[model samples]
Target: MSLEIRSLEIRIAASTDADAACTVLRRSITECCDLDHKNDPAILDAWLGNKTPQMVANWFNSPTNFSLVAVSEGVVVGVALLTGAGKLALCYLLPEARGQGVGKALLARMEEQACSWGVKALQLHSTATGQEFFARRGYVDAGKVRSPYGVETVFFWKQLDAGAEAPDGGKRKRFCNCNPV
Candidate 1:
C-alpha cells in the first residue's frame, strides 16, 4: 500500500494563526467524527465551540496554555493545544493529514512542553474519533465525562515529572527539579 505523504512543518502557534487553528479544529470535529456526532449540534458545540479564534486568544491569557500548528504545503492542516494544569485542550488533524504523522508530532510537542513545565500529569477529554489516537500515545482513560456543552467525552491522562519536582501552578510551589522546555 502507498500514500502520498506531504512535507509538514510543526511550529508553536502564534496569535496570527488563530484563524487557521479554528479551521483545522472545526474540520476535525465536524468532518472526522461519526454521522451521529456530526449531525448533533450539541456535540459540535462541545467539541469545538470554545476553539474559535477569540476563544483561543483568551486561552493565551494564562500563559500556561500553548498552541501549535502543523503546516503542509503552506496550509494549516493540524493543530494541538495544551492548557494550564497540563490539560491537553484540543488536538485535531485535517482528513488528508491523518495517518501521515502530523498528529503524532503535534502531540509530542505538547508532551515535551508538559515535561518541561514540571507538570505532574496531563489530561484530555477525547471523542470517539480521537480515543484510539490518544491511547496509542501512552494515555489511558481515567473515565468519561460530559462537557459544558452537553457532550459526553472520554477522559485520558499521563503523568510527568514524577520524581521530585512538580509545579503547583505558582512561582514558589516547585517541588521537583524542573526541566526547561
Candidate 2:
C-alpha cells in the first residue's frame, strides 16, 4: 500500500526551534531505535544524553552545518542535518511518523541542498533499522563502525553527482537486500 501525507514542508531549522527538534530526536532514539539499543535503559540513557536541546541549538548555530526540519500542521515531524563536507549528520523522525515517506523526502531535500553547494557525495552512519532505508536509496554500505554511544553502526555513502546515475547511463545500484526486523 502507498502512504501519502499532506502539508509536509522541509525548511531550514531555526535556533529557536531546537527544543522541539531535540524532543523529536530524543523520542525517536529512545523509542523507535530499539534495533540498536534493544530497549536497554542504560544504553538509552547514554545515547539520549547527547541528544540535548543545547546540542541541537549548537547545530542550528553552526555555519558549516545545514539543518532542515519537516513540518506538518505547524509541528515538526522530522529533521535532517548535514555538514558542508557532505556528512549526513542526523535524520530522525518521530515513531508515529515512520514508514510514511518522511525520511525519504527529507533525504531528497538534503541531497538537493548539498548539490546546490557543489557537494559530490554524502556519508552517514546508520542503525540497523535505518540501514535498509539508506541502502534502498542507493547508499552503499562501506562497513561497520562503533558509534560514540557504543552502538555498532553501518557506514554508508553515496555519490550525488550526475543525479546519482552511473556513467554508463544505467540506473544506480541499490544495496537494499536487508530484511527488516
Candidate 3:
C-alpha cells in the first residue's frame, strides 16, 4: 500500500505503543532486512530475540533515550530510538512503509532531538539494507563491524549542526509532552 508521506503522524512513542512498535521492529528485521540475515534461522532468532513488547516499553520510558513512532491511519508503521550518547539505536519501517518517506521523517525528528540534547554527532550500526538510506541522509560510512548476531554491519555517522532547528523554526507540533532529562 502506497502512503502519502504527509499523512504520517510522527510522535514520541509511549508505553501504550510498545506492542505495535515491537511488531514493527520484528517484522522490519525479518521481512525487510533479508540481505542482512539471509533468512538464517539462527541470525534472525538472535536479532529478534529481545525485541519484545516489554523491552520496547522499557526503551520508551528510558530517560536517556528518545523513541518515536510513525503512525498511518492509527497503525504504527515505523519506529526509531536515539540515545543520549548520540547513537541511533533503532530505526525500522514496516515492509509496506518502505520508500514512503516515513523513515526520513523519523530520522529527522531524531536528529532534532539529538541537537536539543547537545549531541555533536549521531552514529548508528546499519544493516546492509539500511546503509544506503543512512548514506543518502549524509551519514558517512565509518567502517564495517561484526554485529552480535554475527552479521556484517556498516557503521555510519553524521555530525549535527549546532544551530540546527526544527523545520518549523522551533514551532514543530509537540506530540509528546514529556521532557527529556
Candidate 4:
C-alpha cells in the first residue's frame, strides 16, 4: 500500500534522538549531495568530513539553538536546527520523502522557532543545489562561502518581522508551513 503523506508531528528532540539524527544527517550528505563515498579515498577515511554527531550535539546543546524532528507514523525521516545567529543548522529529508512537503514542514518549524526566539533574520550556508530552494522561500543571496571541507557554499538570508513573538499560549499553531506573502 502507498503511504499517504500527512502532517508530520514535530517536537523538540530528546537525548535519545541524538544518535539517530546523526545517522540521518550523514546519510543525507551521501545520498542528497553528489559527493561520492568512493571518491577521494583519503577524504572518505577521515571522520567528520562535513558533519558529525558531536557537531549536531553541540548544536542542540546551545541555549539559543532549537532543533526539531519530524515524525510521521512514528518514523523519524527529517531533522532541522536553528541557531541563535539565525543560522539554519541542519535541515534534511530522506531521499524517499523529498518533494512531499516534508522539507516545507521542517523549514516552517525552523522559522517558527526563530520567531519565538525573536530572531530578526535567518541565515544559512546552502549548497548550490539548495540555493534555488532557499531562493524560492524568500531567502536572498549574500555571497559565496566556503565550508570546512573547502566546498564553495552559497550564503543566503531572509528578513523576519520583529513584531512576531513566540506564541506564549499556543506555539504549535505558528508552525503550519504558513509563509508570509
Judging by TM-score, tell me the better candidate of 1 and 3: 3
Q: How many residue pairs in model 2 have overlapping backbones?
A: 0
Per-model TM-score versus the true fold = 0.80, 0.86, 0.87, 0.77
The residue ranges of model 2 lying beyond 4 angstroms of the native Cα positions read 1-4, 163-181
Q: What are the per-residue Cα lDDT tens digits for candidate 2 across 53-170?
A: 8999999899999999988778888999999999999999977788878899899988887777877778999998799999998888999999988788999988766545675988
Q: Which stretches of candidate 4 lie over 4 Å from their true place?
A: 1-4, 35-55, 162-181
User: Which ten residues in a row are the worst by lDDT in model 1?
Assistant: 169-178
Which candidate leads the pack in TM-score? Answer: 3
- Across residues 3-31, which tens digit of lDDT does each residue of candidate 3 receive? 55557899999999999999999999999
Q: How would the candidate models be sorted by TM-score, starting from the highest? A: 3, 2, 1, 4
Report backbone clashes per prediction.
Answer: 3, 0, 0, 0
Q: Give lDDT tens digits, candidate 1, residues 1-181.
A: 2334568898988887778878877877777876328577766676676778887656544477787889987888888889867889878888777898988989888877877776777899988778899998777788989767665789998655545342475343332345634
Q: Which pairs clash in model 3?
A: none
Residue 117 of model 2: what lDDT?
80
Instruction: Show where candidate 3 strays beyond 4 Å.
Output: 1-6, 162-181
- Higher-ranked by TM-score: 2 or 4: 2
**How high is the CA lDDT of each candidate model?**
0.76, 0.84, 0.88, 0.71
Which prediction has the highest lDDT against the true structure?
3
Between candidates 3 and 4, the TM-score winner:
3
Clash count (model 1, backbone only): 3
